[model samples]
Every structure is written in structure tokens, then in C-alpha cells.
Target chain A: MTLGQQILQQLINGISLGSVYALIALGYTMVYGIIRLINFAHGEVFMIGAFVGYFIITLFKLPFILALIFAMIFCALLGIFMERLAYKPLRDAPRIAALMTAVGLSIFFQNLMVYLKWIGASPKAFPRVIEITRFEVIENVYLTSDKILTLGVALVLMLALQYVVHKTKMGKAMRAVSQDKDAAQLMGINVDSTISFTFALGSALAAAGGILYAVSYGKIIYNMGTMPGLKAFVSAVLGGIGSIPGAVAGGMLLGITENAVSAAGMSMLRDAVAFAILILILLIKPTGIFGKNTREKV
Target chain B: MKFRSLIKMGVVFAVGFVLHLLIKVGFINGYYDHILTKICMFIIAAVSLNLINGICGQFSIGHAGFMAVGAYTAAIFTKNPDLFIPAAIAGMPRFFIALAIGGSVAAFVGFLVGLPTLRLRGDYLAITTLGFGEIIRVLLLNWKFVGGASGYFGIKPYANFLSVYILAVITVVVLSNFIASSYGRACIAIREDEVAAETMGINTTKYKIIAFVLAAFFAGIAGGIYAHLMQAIMPRDFSFLVSIDILLMVVLGGLGSTSGSIVAAIFLTIVTESLRRFQSLRVIIYSLVLIFIMIFRPQGLLGNQEFSTPMLKEKIRLLFNRTKSGKGHTSTEGTE
Candidate 1:
């Protein structure tokens, strides 16, 4: 492959990776926007989604698309149950308490999955659901069908999410609650259901990301969601927390940079580079690229 | 009053000395003795973290990074014969100096990390500290001098139950006394409300740094003790999970209470050890306990209240009086 082809290949890879990140970041940003709490356990939810996909495909012998749908639905219910059980009671507690609970939940889920008879502690090879056909668009510049599928599915889900947040009644209610819960309540919106809906929406997106990720990587583990979850969070913060479009852009940017670092023959420093970017971005622009600075009322 | 307090401390020291002598004479079994030493180290780590998280109200989640620094520093100091400056001067003084150096390095790193990052409140600081810890672990893994992923080994075992137990007592005493002082009040003020403390002329930033550095220093000390006790140090040992375990100690006991930290540390250490028979079920139970605690008792077991003699006496007196009165409800309202 020539230099141009190499660059193009990496760029394609980056976009595919970025879209998965974008899906996860949307969940984080939406949740943070409403509750002002970082849902650390969302990563575990993503992991569970992957495991659900694994079970559906292997046990039921379902097709990939059907398995993906089942995974998303399972994760959506899991997200709602989690919010109701662990987070709902702590809505009025201190921020630290809520944060620690999220961390505890993350630990709990990881350990529970590990101790389960079927999952165990090992990483399972993800089955290739569909045959991959590499298409050579230009000389030496190749794109696989898997990559295109990832990008296409992610774009469609994000577009759907945008519609939900803008074009639908529940979406409008979600917007109002996120803006101000008390005001939304005064306007007769059920704040509780809206929050639950938001959680479900975000979780379904994360499940899609998880399935796509397994397809792209050909492997899934109980704890596979932690690193990606963290990076997506970085993307959420980078794009400006609570902004939908910002998450997409940030995810793409993060993916390109991470892949670029590995492309430069510094693969060992890849994870470190991502975290370094997070620290630098936070120091320079805490509100992120598209975030507006909100004044803290004393 | 100061003299009386000093006398009480002297008596406690004498008792500890006698206990040490008994252990040295094999009065206690080796297994229980090791557990006691471990309990002491956990007590120190938990109490020190309480000072920062509970008293200062700073959300720090990278304590294991500081422990790693201390452990590596002590390991290297004891291993490299050419680097043994104090050890050459005296045989026993070497361990003390190595422990001090380990603590100082970790404290310095804490200062550097906290200087800029501590200004940001809540999750930002928490994430940054956590990142810094991961960075340290990664750095340790890449650096070959300290054995990297293979771990640093072959260090002489100098840490013993007597020294570790004494240090634990000192940590508790120092932290409890500090919390009872004006500086501690400043820390509490910051915990209550940073803006209010700032308006009241308390240097919130300065006090926060002090508490953070102090906590790091003691954590480093615990790490140093842990390294010598095990005679080997590994990067994986100080992962973020360990940090969470330490935090659990503080939260379980009661944040901001020295006695609470101590009780929680000992209780958790024993419980965890006893649960080893259940294999992986221990972690699941542990996580469930954390969730349950947060749901039912978010303020913790003691909720910033220490175990005082007066309270214990009041409880005992109430118990006796209740039996005498033959009624439980009447005295229960007035006793507390």
C-alpha cells in the first residue's frame, strides 16, 4: 500500500471505530445532561449487551441482525432496571454518594459476569455472522463490508436518536426535563418516565455499539466495555457534554487520533495517548469544543 | 489535661511493647500475627484516606497510584546495594529512611497532581487523579529497572508487626489530633461548602492541598510497609480496585471519623479473609454490600461521629436503667 492508501485505510478504520464510540458517548452525554451524574456503570451495560449478543447467537442460533435486536432490547430493560433499583433512590442524595454507587455497580456487574458459569473470566471469540468482502475502491486502498456496515448502522441509530430528541413528544419532554426538572414537572411532564426513557434510549444505542464492536474485533469479554466506555466518556466531554452532535464529532476525532498514534509505530502508547488527550482537553477546554460555559450560581 | 493525655499514650505504648514482646516470643501464632499486621496497614490506609475524602470533602480516586510509588521506591532502595547510603551507615536505620523516602516521593507526586487539578471540584478531580494513577502503573510497567510487568522482587523483609502496628497507632493519633485542631476545622469547612469557606476567609485551596498531601504521605507509608511485608512489589497489586477497597473501608466505617475508619478496616479485613473460603463469591458479596450500604445508609455506619467513651457509658447506663424501670420506650427518648 502506498502512503496515500495507507492513510486512507487507517482513516476508514478510524471512522468505524469512532462510530462505535459515538454510540456509547451519546448514552453518557444524554444521562449527564439530565441528572448531572456520570453513569460509570454504563460501561458494564455495554459489556452486558455484548454478552447478550453472544448468548442470543450461540444459544438460539439466531442470525446476526436478529441477535443484535434482542441484545438492544435486553440492554434497554437492564438500563431501566438499573436506574430504578440503584440510582432512583439516590436522586436526592449527595453527588459523591451517587457517583460511588455507580462505581460499585460497575464492580458488581463485572464480578457477577465473571463468576457466572457460562461467561467465566475468559474472553470468547466473537463468531463471524456475515462473510466479509473487501472492496478495493482505489489501487491498494481497500474497504471491507464490515466497516461500511458499522458506519451505516451507527449513522442510522444516531439519526434516529436525533429525531427522538427533537421530533417526538417524548423527546420534547426529555428536552424539557433536562433543561429544568422542576419546570418540566410544573408543565405536567412525568419527569420520572422521561428519565427512564432517556436511559432506555441511551442503553439501546450502547448495545448497538457493543454488537458492532464485537463484529469488528471478533472478540468479546466481560470487562471489554471499560476502556471503550472511558474513551467514549472522553469523547462526550470533548464534544461538549450534553450536546448530541458534539459527541459524534468528538468520537470521530478521538478515534482518528488513537489510530494515528498506532499508525506512527507507537502502539504501546495508544491507551496512554488517549488518556493524555483527555487530560489536555480538560485542562484547555473543560466545556469541550461545542460546550457553552454555564455560570455556577452560588 | 495534656499531661494526663501523655500518660495515657505512655500506658498504651507500654502495653503495645508487651504485646510485641509476646509475639516475638511466639505467644501468638504466625497466621494470626500476619493478619494483625495486615489489619494495621489497612487501618492506616483507611484513616488517611478519610482525612482527604471525608474531612476535606475532596473526591480522590487514585490512591493506589501513590501506594505504587511508595512500594516501588522502598523496593528499589532495599534492593540496590550501591544505592544503600543509610543502610551502610547503620543496619536498622536503613528501613526507616527507605520508608521516609518512599512517603516523601509519593507526597511530592500528590502535590504535583493536586496543585492544578484540585482546583476543579467533583468528578473532574476524581477522574484526573484516577488517570494519574493509571499513568503511574503504566509507567511502572514500561520501566525495566523495577522489573516492569514481571514485578520487583528479592527485597529483604524488614517490615514487622511491631513497627507496622506502632505506625498504625501513630497514624490514628496524628489524624484524630489534627482533625481536632483549627486546621481540621478549615478542612471540615471546605467539605461543608467551598464557597462559604472561601467567604469566611478560609484558604480552601491551601487546606485541600495539605489534606491531600498528608493522605498521600500516609498511603505511601502503608505501601512501604506492605512491600516489606510481602518481600515483593507488583504493579498489578496497586490497581484501581485496591483504591476502591481502601475507599470502602472509609465509607463503611463512617467518613471523617478516625475510630470509624479503624473499626471498619479491622472488620472488613477480617470479613474478607474469612470469606476466602467462598472463592469468587466474596467479591460479589462485597459489591452487593457496597450497594446496600449506599442505599440504606449513605451517611455510613457512624456518619462522621466517632466512638466516644461518654457515648458508650451513656448507652450502658441507659441499658441498666431500662431494665430497672421495666420499660424500654420511656427512657429511650430521653437517653440519647
Candidate 2:
């Protein structure tokens, strides 16, 4: 491929990668929006989603779409379970308590998968549910079926999320609670249920991202969530933590920059590049690209 | 004051001599000695981390990064022969110098990192420090002079049970004294309320940096001790997992309690070693315990309370009084 074609190809790949990151970033942004918790275990939820999708396909002989749905639902339930068991009781405690618990839960999920009877400390291959060969768009730039599907599904889920947050009753409740929990409670909104729903929605999106990630990568590991989870978090912060559109923009930006660096023969430094951006963004514009600076009230 | 401190040092030395004699007499075997040294090193790490995360109210997850800086620096100093510091000066004094260099370098790095990031609060500070840790690991992995990802080796084993025990004692004493000082009170004030403390003329940023740098300095010393004891150092030795492990010890011990960190460090090290055979299952159990602790007792077992003899006596008295009062009540009321 010519340089132009190479750039275009990388762009396509970057967008596909970014969309997956966007899906995960949405979960982080949404949860951070409602409750100020970072939810460090959200990454593990994504990992579980991938494992769930893998099992649904391999064990039950389900189609890819059905497996994806099952994975999403399973992860949603897991998210709720996590909030209830590990987070809810600490809702009024020090923030560090919840943060530490999330970190512990993250470790628990990773190790549990590692030592679990069915899943040992090894990477599992994800079976290809839909097979389509790469095709050249203009005699040089090629696109794969997996990339197209990832981008498509990510876009669809994000749109659905937007609708839920803006055009529905539950979404309105979420907005109200996020805006002011006590006031929303006074307005007859169930703050606890809304927060739980926000977790479920975010976890479901993360599950979709996880399934898509496994499908594209063709291999899944127990600790796979650490790096991607971190990068997605960076993306969320980059796009302004509590903003949905900002997450999409940040994810895409991160993907393209990382891919471009790799394309320039710096694959080893790509992770560092992401972290560098995180530090730089934090140092300069901590509110993130799309985040508005809110004055701190005494 | 100087005389009192001298007496304290003499007591510490006497204890160390007795411990060394016990080891020499075969009362403590090599396996147990190793475990004791490890427990000492972990105590240093956990206690120092508690200074920042628990006392200063800053969430610092880059402790292993600081430890790595110290370990690698010490490893390079001892292994490389053509150095500025002469081997003629290379006995106990040399070991101390190497430790100082390791700690100072890590503290310097901590200063640099903290200057930019310490102004941020809570979770943001945590992520930034975590990033710095990963950056340090990556840099160490790629940098060739310190052996990179291949592992640095051939360090002289200057650390022993006696030295580690002494250092551990010094750590606890120095930290306890520091906490009892006014600067430490400033840190506590920052933890209680940064805005209020700032309004009250406390330099929150300065105190935060002081705590972070002091914590890093001790962690670096612990890393030096660790490097000498293991006789080898690797980039993988200092990762996020190490940071999390140290944090777990501090958190489980109860935040803001130095004595609690000491006890928790000893207890958790024993538990971890006992469960070593279980491999991954051990960490799973740890995570469950952590979650349970957060849910049921977020204050931890000690919860800002110290392990003072008077306090323990008082607690026992209180318990006895409660039972005595209950006994005086009707047996049916007690049953109800």
C-alpha cells in the first residue's frame, strides 16, 4: 500500500479500535457521572463479558449475536451484584474505601478466572462467529469484516445509550440523580435504582466492547482487562469524564494516536504514549477536552 | 533529648544483638530468618505507604515505582566495580551510603512527580501516580544500563537479618516520632480537611509533598534492603501488583494508624506465606477479605486506633465491665 493508502488503512483500523474503547469509556463516564466513584472493577466486568460470550458460543452453540446478548445481560447482572455487595454499603463511607474495594474486586475477578476449574491460567482462543475476508476498497486500502462489525455495533450501542440517557424515563431519572441526588430523591426519583441502572447500562456496553474485542483479537486472557481498561479510562478522562459524546471523541482520538504511533514503528511505546497523553491532559486541562470547568464551591 | 535518643538507639542495638545471637545459636532456622527479614521489609513498605495514603490522605499507588528506583539504583551501585565511591570505604559505611543514594534518588524522583501531581485530589492523584509507576517500569524495561527487562544481577548481599531488623526498628521509631511532631499534625490536618487546613494557614501542598517524599525515601530504603537480600533485581519485581499489595497491608491494618500497619504487616505476611502453596487461590481469598472488610468494617480492625498498652488495657476493662453489667441483668434479659 502507498503511504496515503497506508494512512487510510490505519485510520480505518484506528476508528475500529477507538469504537471499542469508546464503548468501554462510556461505561466509565456514565458511572463517574452519576456517582463520583471510578469503579476500577469495571475493566474486569469487561473481561467477564468476553469470557461469558466465549462460553455462550462454544458451550451452547449459540450464534454470535445471541452470544453477545447473553454476555451483555450477564455482565449487567454482575455489575449490579458488584454494586450491591461491594459498593452500596460504602456509599456514605470514605471514597478510599470504595476505591480500594474496587481494586480488590478487580484482583479477585482476575485471579478467580485464573484459578477457576474451567478457566486456568491460560489464554483462550475466541472462535470466529462471522467469517469474511478483507476486501480492498480502492485497490490498496483494505477493510476486514471484524472491523466493520465492531464499528457498527459500537455505534449502534452508543446511539441506544444516548437515547436512554436523553429520551427515556429511566434516563431522566439518571440525569436527575446525577444532577442532585437529594433533590432528585425529593422529586420521587429512586436514586439507588437509578445508580444501579446506570451500572447495568455501563456494564452492558462494556460487555459488548469485550465481545467485539475478543472477536477481533481472537484470544482472551484473564488479565486482559488491565491495559485496555486503563486506556479506556484515559479516553474517558480525555473526553471529559462525565460526558458521553466526549468519551466517543476521546476514544477515537486515543486509538488514532496510538495506531499512528505503532504504524510509525513505535509499537512498544504505544502504551506509554497513551499514559503520556493522560498525564499531559491532566496537567494542562484536567477538565478534559469536552469537560467544562466548574468552579469549586466552598 | 539527645541522651534519651541515644538510649533508644542503644536499646535497639541490644535487641538486634540478641536477635542475631538467637539466629547464630540455631534457635531460628534459615527459613524462619528469611521470613522474618521479609516481614521486616514489608513492614517498612506498608508503614511508609500508610504515611501518605492513610495519614496525608493522598492516594499514592506508585510506591513500587519508588521501590524500583531504589532497588535498581542500589543494584547498579553494588554490581559496577568502577565507581566513584571506593571499595576501601565499602564496608558497613559503604552499605549505608548505597542505601542513602538509593533512597535519595527515589526521593528526588518523588519530589519531581509530586510537584506536578500532588495538587490534585484523591482519585486523580492516584491515577497520575499509577501512570508514573508504569512509566518508570517501562523506562526501566527499555533502558539497557540497569539490565532492562532481562533483570539486574550480581549485587553484593550486604543485607542480613540483623541489618533489616535494625532498619525496621529505625523506620518505626522515626515514623512514630515524625507522626508525633507538628509537621505530621499538618498532614493529619490536610487529611481531615484540605480546604479548612488551607484556610487555617497550613500549607497543604508542602505537607503533602513532605509526606510523599518521606514515604518514598523509606520505601526506597526498603527496596535497597530487598535488592541486597534477594541478590538480584528485576523490573517485574516492582509493578502495580506490588503497590497494591503494600496498599492492602496498609488498608487492612486500618488507615491512619502506624501501629496498626505494623501489626497488619506481620499478620498478613504470615497469612500470605502460609497460603503460598495455594498459589492463585490465596490472592482470591485476599480480595474477598478486602471486600468484606470494606463492606462490614470500612474502618478496618483498628480504624485510626493505635496498639498502645494503655489503650489495650482500657479496652479489656471496658469489655469486662460490659460482661459484668450483663451478668447483673436478668438471665432472661440477657437471653433476649
Best by DockQ: 2
TM-scores, all models, native as reference: 0.94, 0.94
Docking quality level of the chain pair in candidate 1:
medium
Candidate 1 local lDDT, B188-305, one digit each (tens): 9998888889889998889999999999999898898889888888898898778888889988988788889999999988987788786457777777777888888887767888
Q: Which pairs clash in model 1?
A: none
lDDT of 2 by residue, A1-298 (tens): 6899999999999999999999999999999988888888988999999999999999999999999999999999999988888888988987878888888898899999989989988999999887868988886898999999999899899889999999999999998988888999999999999999999999999999999999999999998887788889999999999899999999999999999999999888988988888878877888899997776456
Q: What is the alpha-carbon lDDT for the whole of candidate 1?
A: 0.86
How many angstroms is residue B178 displaced in model 2 relative to the true structure, after the best TM-score fit? 2.6
For candidate 2, the TM-score of chain A alone relative to the native chain A = 0.98
CA-lDDT, candidates in order = 0.86, 0.87
